[model samples]
Target: MTLFVAGLSHKNAPVELREQLAVEEDKLRELLSDVSATGAVRETLILSTCNRVEVYGVAEAPGEARAVVFRHLCRYRGVAYGSVEPLLYTHLDGDAVHHAFRVAASLDSMMIGEPQILGQVKDAFGLAQACATVGPALHTLFTAAFAVAKKVRTETEIARHAVSVSFAAVELARKIFAGLGGKAVLLVGAGKMGELAARHLVEHGAFPVYVANRTWPRAQEMARALSGAAVPFAELETALAGVDIVITSTGATEPIVTLAMVQRVMHGRRARPLFFIDIAVPRDVEGSVNTLADVYCYNVDDLKQVVEANIRERLREAQRGEALVMREVAKFLTRQSDVEVIPTIVSLRERLEEIRVGEVRKALARLPGATAETREAIEALSAAIVNKILHAPITKLRESSRAGSSRSWLPLIHELFGLGRK
Candidate 1:
């Protein structure tokens, strides 16, 4: 069987296209079943994330399996094939294995070396197994991918720096304060990005965290999760005055933290430095807030600079990770090649045994006076001859696999032995 991967990623498609194809777990289950029901692939797994949507499958024909995956992605998401065809990419056999290992190691992330993608991959694998779409092929591939990821984490420094926007924000805060110990932090929006930054801040010893959102319940929920206090939306200005760091990532189109709002809060703090990290798309903090003395403001664009530099360092480390993953991929493929030849070996052994049994039976019939002892001797002699005849061919077949010449000899072996194709 052929192993393959087909999909689009952040490298080939825009966010709008990626978002259109993103699947929730429930939908992903249905999609996995749908793809397998088409009978084009023997095993399948789908990995969907904010940055990519890919299907990994095993089939007798790689081309047909890849085509089926592409068609399914377009049909399931209500997207036109024409729109997606240009952006889609396919990797077959060894290339597919390499891609899977790189992805699991977070080397394929939009922000390389980020940790979230590994967990996302695991979740996808688990969901596919639950849907019964995963079989031996995918099971082997995913489990090896997980091992490669673990090796990358332990062997390289790729994930040691902050490469994400949220983590970069924390790095910036730490730089400004020399350290975040005993500093108060306020999450202005309680969105995913803000929550991640707050988490990092807490990790760095920031205490008495406060979460404020437009919806009171969400604020409370996030506050509870972070082990902090929930502040009312109206009390945002008061929270601002109390905290030394503010991370905002709301869905608002307009600025929520205005110059005047921060200006009012700064007066009560007696020149205490407050850092605002605005990770929102439309700019959560007014740009003019940076004009105020002892107050620092950074938007997403500003953080990208930090992310860029961190990414450069990560790239240096990722080289080492890539080498490790490639080594693991080679080992996995060698094991798979050895496995691929087992059916042929079994067929060969059975064919020899069939001939030996028939010959021994015919000999015993010819000698009506043969005693039980003589018959047993004949049976033993025939079995030894069969084993001797089969030994060299079986050993050669295995050696061919290690030498990467199995494809050259496998078909010949089947034809010569009159064995049906596996």
Candidate 2:
């Protein structure tokens, strides 16, 4: 069977297209069920993140599997298949293995070396297994991918910097102020990344002016714990004008902070300058808001370029990680090849042993007057001959796997040894 991965990522599509296809964890099982029902996939995984939507699977034909995956994504997103067909990429066999390893290693991230994708990949794999969409093929693929990612993490300095979108927002905020000290900040969501960004702001000496969440109690508790005043969720736009920095990570599907909303807030500030960091996947702030005067808006994808400054140093190490992935893939394939020949080798050995034992038994039966020592010697002699006779062909069959050139000789060997269907 051929292993394959088919999907679209940040390299081929913008966030506009990506968000349209993004599947939440709640939809994972349903999506996997539909994909598996297509009958093209033997094993399957759907990895849906902010940056990508990919399906990895094993099938007899790679093209058919890729088509099934692409069709599923289009159908799930309610988009025309022709519209996204050009954007999708498919990798088969070794290339598919490389894609998986690179993705798990975070090398394929928009912000290369970012650590979040590794966890995201793990979560997708876990979710697929939980849904029972995965069997040994995907199991082997993901486990190897996880191992490669771990090796990259422990062996490389790529992720030593806190260079995620959240951290990038804080860095941009710092560029605006000589320092973050005394700056008034408003954190709009209690999202994990947003909360992390708030902590970083506090570290940089910025003061939390407001914390507003959709849930009032969470906003109140977060505000109190962060030493900031809680604002009613309805007054989010009102809170925007007063704060120097706004970080939003709301779960809203559409833009919450639109250009008109920012324009209304900017009027009250009188060109005081408002900085917005929207770290949400679907993006809380409107894309057009970045065009507003005296306003700086940065979204998750915008952080991609910001991360490259530190990433230049990690390229050499990434090459080493790539080499390691290739090596691991080779070893895994070799082992699989070796496993395929085991039954044939066992059958051949068993057939020879049957002959040796039968002949020894016949000789023992004919020698009723023979001593016990003589019978033992005859049995030992027969066993030794069987082992020596079987050794050469077994060794050759096993070694042939490493060279990957055994298909022609395997059937011939089986026929020559009269080993089949037993």
Candidate 3:
């Protein structure tokens, strides 16, 4: 099977399109299983993040795999097939490998060098494996992709700056308070992005996190996981008064935290400085919250600008990361090609062994007084000789398969051996 990747990212599609295609966590397993069942794909993994929804697979036919993925995406998003077709992009074989490596390394993220994509990629792989949609080919590909990401992270300065919305939120908080230690942080929603940002805050030594969500159980669960406390949604004002940082990422259709409510909370807190990070797409916190004194409010767009500026600053390091990804992609492609070469090499060896055994039998049949033991010894010696003669060539062929120019030598070996004809 050949490797293939087809989908659209923030670079290729707008946010409206991406949001339409975004797969919820609950639907991921079913979707991956259904896509893999299409029979065109041998193995499949779907990565659905806020910025991109990509399907990576190994398939007998690249076009068929692409078509299957495209149809599924269109159906899931409830979009006309023709409307979505123009935004889709497809990559095959080496290009697919390159794309996977680049994505894992954060080179293809909307915010370059963002670390969240690595985790998202890992989650996708895990889900695919759990659903049995990931087999040998996809497992190897994803593992290699992760290894490439780690190499780029450690060897290059690509991740030197915080280039994600969550990290940018933390950066803004740091600018406001100068230090996060001993500061209480209130997370208004239990969304993945909010949890990530809260985790970052805790990692930076923020203390006594208070989580509030529409669902108390989820809020309590997240609080327990983070070693924090759960506060009811009704007690948000009280929670807001006690916290130095407020991060909101709810999916509310309207503003959850309005200017009037924040102003009242400010009064209760004696006008203590509050850092409000609205990381939600629809914006949980009101825009006018920034007008209040001692209140620093940042929205998604503000964080996006921060991410953009940081990306520009890290362009030089990103180039180094890109070079590393290229090297890894080449390595992975060489290994995959070698997988294809092994069966051919084994078939050729078996053919040579058959010829040697047949020739030895014929020669031994004509020998007078050739006892059973003598005949067996002759056959063994002939087999040994054949093995010794072919050993170096077979070793060289395997070694050459790892080099970029291995294709050039394949036809030569086939010609020299004349092994294809019956």
Candidate 4:
């Protein structure tokens, strides 16, 4: 199958277009199932974040998979096909694999080396798995991409500084509280970024965690996973009063926590310092909440400065990460090229073996004086000779397949061996 990727990202499209194409967590399974049903795509995964909307898939043809994906995106977004075509970007086979690796490594992030995309990619794969849209090919490709990302993170200093929304939240909490240990962290919603931030806090020794969500079951699920307590959405004010830090990532169309709500909570705690991180796209906490005394509220845009600064400090490491991606792309390309020639080589080998066996059998019947044991010995010798003659050519064909130059040698091999005439 031919691998292909098509979509738009922060680098190629504005936030408006990206947001328009973004798929919600609840919608992912259905979207993937629909895309996979198109028959043009064999396996599919959709990665939809605030900064990008990418569809990765394998198909029988290169351009055909991309066309199918593009059409689906246009249909989902209600954008005219003609209007959306100009904004979409398509990558085929090797380039598609390279893009997936780079994205997982955060090399193509708005802030280079940011770590959030890795988790986002994982979530996408999970959804695809649940929808039965991912088979062995995609499973292998995604697992390898994750491995490469881990290698880049551990072997290089790409993540030396916090450069993602989630990491930035951790950094801000650190600056405000002097230390994360023994701090009370309240996660307002269980969105992906908020969950990631909560994990980071827990890693850094934050204790007595509390999670509140619109859905009590989801909140309880996250709480149980993190070994924390779950509070009802109605008790958000009470939960806020007890926590030293708050991270919000709800998907509300409007602000969930207002200035008045936070101010009311501050009264119960005697205005103790509280770090509020608003990582949601539409923003959960109101802008006015930042003005409250002893309340430090930071929005997504404000965090970008810290993320950008961290990216600047890791430029050297990022160069090394880029080199790794290039090497991986080369290796993936070689394998993909080899896949194309495998069937042809197998067919040719079978043809040759059939001819050799047929000739040996015909000659044995003509030898009337030959005994059974003699005929069997002659047949074995002919088989050995045929194997010895073809070994070098077979090995060379396999090697040529991997180098992506099989087309150049295929015609000559076919003519010399008369592979198909029989």
- Per-model C-alpha lDDT, please? 0.90, 0.84, 0.86, 0.85
**Model 1 spans > 4 angstroms off:** 164-202, 205-307, 343-395, 411-422
Question: Residue 373 deviation, candidate 3, in Å?
Answer: 20
Model 2, total clashes: 0
For model 1, how does the per-residue alpha-carbon lDDT over 350-372 read when each residue is reduced to its tens digit? 88888888888899999999999
- Which residue window of length 10 is worst by lDDT in model 3? 402-411
lDDT of 3 by residue, 1-422 (tens): 67889888999898998888888877887777778777888889899999988899888898788778778877877888787778888898789989999999999987677789999999999988889999898898889999999999898878876777898888778888879999999998899989999999999999989999999999999999899999999988878889999989999889888899999989977878999988887999999989999998889899899978777777888899998888888878778878866766887788798999789879987897899899889988998898898887777777787764557666777778877842
Pick by TM-score: which candidate is best?
2
TM-score of 4: 0.57
Q: 1 or 3, which is superior by lDDT?
A: 1
lDDT of 4 by residue, 127-226 (tens): 9999999987788789989988998888788888786778878988888887899999999889888888899999999998999999999999999988
lDDT of 1 at 291: 93
Which candidate order results from sorting by lDDT in descending order? 1, 3, 4, 2
In model 2, which runs have C-alpha deviations exceeding 4 angstroms?
A: 164-309, 368-380
Q: For residue 15, what is the lDDT in candidate 1? A: 98
lDDT of 4 at 154: 86
RMSD of each: 8.9, 11.4, 10.3, 11.1
Best by the lDDT measure: 1
My TM-score estimates for the predictions, one after another, are: 0.63, 0.64, 0.58, 0.57
Q: Write the per-residue lDDT of candidate 2 for residues 1-422, one digit (tens) a residue.
A: 78899899999988898998898987778878887888888889989999999999998887887787777777878888887888889998778888999999988888767888999999999999998988988898788889888988888766665456677777788788778998999999888888888888988899856899999999988888788888998898888878999889999998888899999998888888889888898999998988988899888878777766546656756777777778877877777778778888888888898888889889989999999899989988998988898889888888886676667658978889888763
